[model samples]
Target chain A: MNRLLAATLLSLVSSPVLACDAVQLGTIEVEQAWSRASIGTSRPGVVYLTIRNAGTEDDALVSIDTPISGMPMLHETVVTDGIASMPHAMEVPVPADATVALEPGGYHGMLMDLTQVLKEGESFPVTLTFRNAGEVTVPVSVQGVGATDAGCSENNG
Target chain B: MRLTRLQKALWVAAGLAIVAFGVLVTIMNRAPEPAAQASFRPTFSLPDAEGRLRTAAEFEGKHLLVFFGFTNCPDVCPTTLSEVGQVMDDLGDEAEEVQPLFISIDPERDRELGLAEYTNAFHPAILGLAGDQAQTRAAADSFHIYYEREDTADASGEYSMSHSPALYLVGPEGDWLRQFTYGTPASDIVSDLQSRL
Candidate 1:
């Protein structure tokens, strides 16, 4: 019926809204988690998703943790020399009452040496530790093995 | 009628010029010129998901669409490969003429088995290429591609890469061809390949 009402209903059905009481800084929510399938002689894959910050104070995502791989790291994508080059994780600064997206062709998390192929219709837990806010566990949805788009036909796209 | 015969000639010339202008306009309304062809097709060797070595040179004399990215790349990597897959489908049998390559920038982890497995998830023709950093860098430089690592640290004291997203069109000669921007439709890629054929 209204904008607020619609946003509320959509969040409930799909993306779960996460905001904690202690930080007073903000809440970071992860959704639509996915990784590319292992390719040609390579066993490990990378994971991607959005880390939305919903709060009143500035939010900085310092690190990410996942058990599926030997190591979990955050990264940002850059293009140089007509190539895609990623160096390291950027301090994702989510402004007060705003959201920062971690989508395809951009910044995402790196999941290395996965225990197994992250299957679709299944989800895994990844704990994100914020500089100001403590650790928050988010269930990452393992998208289809063939899923290409970061997310099309959905808001993530 | 006071004018001379030469004056009459001048009036006819003016009329001819006016008609010629109209004809020029009609000619200008013809179809547009086709898109440009790729400069050259470049080739490199990288491991697959199963650790098998495949070379771009091996696919020579065939239409090839290769993209450079890493398996650790969750979003752009898959999207670009998927787009290449879509282009392959668009070509149907002609798609066989074009080979799709999924090259990884993150050679640190995208060894033989990882690369092969990652690429297999997409189209079979879509091969994944990976090598040691030294080899990968040489390949990247030859193709005029660029990539760098971002500083994303996890609990295990490690890093990740954040690189560019590029789709290179390598011709039969293993030279660099043209490229499509991100989000380009498969139909567009197919159309380009058709012209090359």
Candidate 2:
């Protein structure tokens, strides 16, 4: 390229307006992730994790990413009339500079199709990809054996 | 440090023997307990299938047989509900004294209409209880219930929850009574409930 063209390109690439901008990337903070102990039989499991807004801009959790399973979804567990129902949570709101928690029976990352049983004393990595917070991976701790009250003490029969 | 060839061979043989012994032991181990221990009854506050909040006090005057399940539950929930319904029917009027409550552990999708429709399939008066996380947990806690949300990928390209399958029996005062095995017969259950009653 000619000297004039090179100078112009350099000026554009190294523009002063593009330098020292903190608004380029949003910051995110993830809290501890844990789940009840895995049961021996084919029991259910839930993974709990917290996502904090560490930036000034508004953001939302568009989706969750997991490497251990084919698909990771967001779901809410509700009880109406006298039945327990679970429905998909298409999008979890993580307002600007706010935190959204994924806990039991709430907004949690529903890992579909476990490649392997979630055995006790063992943890596998799962990633949550947020709309603004990006993606963060965590090793969830499974709780409660075939136990229904997820975190409560066992009934010693 | 390197081990001698003989030492390596011995170690390998020992490892193989241990592996074989482990396999033998695993095979000898009997089947795991199908249901959780039901040493005591539990209390909870959840909405009935009609969408009305229900507390353990709703049946404080009589025995309560509570099971955590959902309307949409294909095999486990329906089976347990039907069996319990049978046990209730076998009890005749005594079954009236022993209130049978079906509390949905999968509350998110089990709304009032859904619960009513699903529960009515098994038997009338199989009261369904559905609550939010906090209310559901409290009720489950009283019963010492255990359940978790297992994610499943659906064909339509979404995920579903797989939860714990268990049943509980609370006393007249809403105290933890006992839990039944998944395949427990109605006869045995009626007998157990009669003894308690």
Candidate 3:
């Protein structure tokens, strides 16, 4: 009976790792890392997520890396006088104890020269580098092209 | 001097007639003015997602919602197209009369297949279009669209483009109808389109 109970308890403990979409490390909580599925033959794919710094010290997102693309660059879409422009961002700021959303129409990461299409329902690992919090590897869930509201949380459910 | 009964009735009838005429004139003056006619819509024969040459003449009896953007556009294009998709949803059956096309300003990056993938991903009805630089420029000049290509640090000759985000609504007869500014709600677009239809 004790052996059976131990097995059941072990299964319960391992389930959280499979269900959790959030990765909390040190003072940073990264949630909802997601990307839209690439359209036919589109080489570049975009990724978005929310980074929250729960600690008092501010952090800067130094860089990002993923196996799906050799060069993942930070970019933001700027609109002036009804003109839309996407400019390269050298670094992104994560204010202390505040949440910063890297979402559509704002800050985003471009996966340049994707070797393969980012299909829907597929999840890939992306490593994010922070000046203060170090590096954390998060899974980015791929969603449909029209998906803006759907995220890793929904897919986790 | 007191008038006779017949004369009094005749006088009252004349007064009533004059009051009716005054009311009629007031209503005529108060009625709203007619809507101003739109300028001529610029026509183009661009390659669609399938690499097929599609012309403005093909959609002669259907209204078109044309927008200019590129596939690499991560933010505004998707947002606007998604909103346009919502407008299509709100339209229901009337959407059959309305067709949406996404014209690529960056033809170098947005090829026929890529354009097809990007546009139809938002809404099935949204068709993607692309053409060479000269064709794009001519189309832009005709539509009065302003766009600029900014060089990027990447070595692959890949660059970013900046262009207007307005949604152009073209009439069934290939005439310019209206332009919806960016961030306009889907309900407003649907209502405007419904009223026009």
Candidate 4:
């Protein structure tokens, strides 16, 4: 019983810290990963994050994997002539020493076939694979429904 | 040439007739064109989330905020709805006089997915409307909204919908008032609505 209590306390104390910290692999830093609370299980969800490449070499986000979703894909919402179309992005190129922000009304990570409803204040782990930087898992916090931004300071890292 | 009294009276009548015809033509050209007005002033009859038949007449005396989108849309639709919610909140008590309707372009899937639940997550005041394919098409036609399903579908047979992203504002008299284009800030929309309301 004492061991179980200690494990529970440790999980509660470590979860938030893990979600708040930015993950760095090589020179690629992934931060401010967040998603809005889902309305229903049938519809898809989305994840927004910022990827900054500090190295002189350019990289690209090739793929994404998350246990919360069955099919995770990178999609871009293109608005042309007042029409909006969401197309599957083959890959998002991150230039050298530049930041690529996956935001609303632009590029975003589409979470298809959600296993469970994303509740507010919860966090999920998503493994983002880069062409050059390899793979790095980042914790994505679930914000309120219709949240525009992560609503947190970048200094949390 | 000297004219007789009868000829002089006939000449005066002809001049008066020409003047009257010129005045009539100018008035006709200056009058509002019904065809142009009718094109802009569109109406619709569809079923709401509660399955009740709702028409434009039902929203008489209140401004109608209409947007066309689908619940399956993960990005632009929700972002626009959130901005609409912000506008409503900024309106404060004046929001009561505004009715925001989210018309689903993908009605079949939206109905099964629970449209009300999806919209209420952004704003409870936003009413989600869906209809059969024919009815949905008719409503979209009236509003000049365009929507097309992509040929590509996921392994689960789910597809995405491409649609117009403009938010239309209808006056209390059921006339097209203004259009808030995609990405317009909520503050601008609130100020416009407040001035009109």
TM-score winner among the candidates? 4
Give candidate 4's error at residue B149 in angstroms. 0.6
- Prediction-by-prediction clash tally: 71, 46, 0, 0
Q: Candidates ranked by TM-score, best first?
A: 4, 3, 1, 2
Q: What is the Å distance of residue A4 in model 4 from its true position?
A: 12
Show model 2 residue runs off by greater than 4 Å. A1-157, B1-41, B153-160
B-chain TM-scores per prediction: 0.72, 0.73, 0.77, 0.80
Q: Show model 3 residue runs off by greater than 4 Å.
A: A1-20, A40-42, A152-157, B1-40, B50-52, B185-188
Q: Give lDDT: candidate 3, residue B68.
A: 91
Worst 10 residues of 2 chain A by lDDT: A16-25
TM-scores vs. true structure, each candidate: 0.63, 0.44, 0.76, 0.85
**Chain A TM-score of model 4 versus the true structure?**
0.88
Q: Write the per-residue lDDT of candidate 1 for residues A1-157, one digit (tens) a residue.
A: 6999977645533432221111122365555555544432124456665556676678787888877777666776666554556656756676766657666667677776677666554555667778877777665555556665333344333
The DockQ-based CAPRI class assigned to model 1 is acceptable
- Score candidate 4 by DockQ: 0.68
Residue A105 lDDT in model 3? 81
- Residue B183 lDDT in model 1? 64
Please, what are the lDDT tens digits per residue for candidate 2 over residues A1-157? 6999977646533332211121212477664455434322233345666667777877777776655556556666554432344677788877766777665445666655545666544445566677756766555544332222223223310
Better of 1 and 3 by lDDT: 3
Residue range B1-197, candidate 1, lDDT tens digits = 59899999999999999999989876675435222342544556766666677777678788677677766555566778777777777788887778787777877666633556566667777877677888788777767666776563447544446555767787777766777877677778888889888
**lDDT of candidate 4?**
0.88
lDDT of 1: 0.65
- Give DockQ per model, in order: 0.36, 0.02, 0.44, 0.68
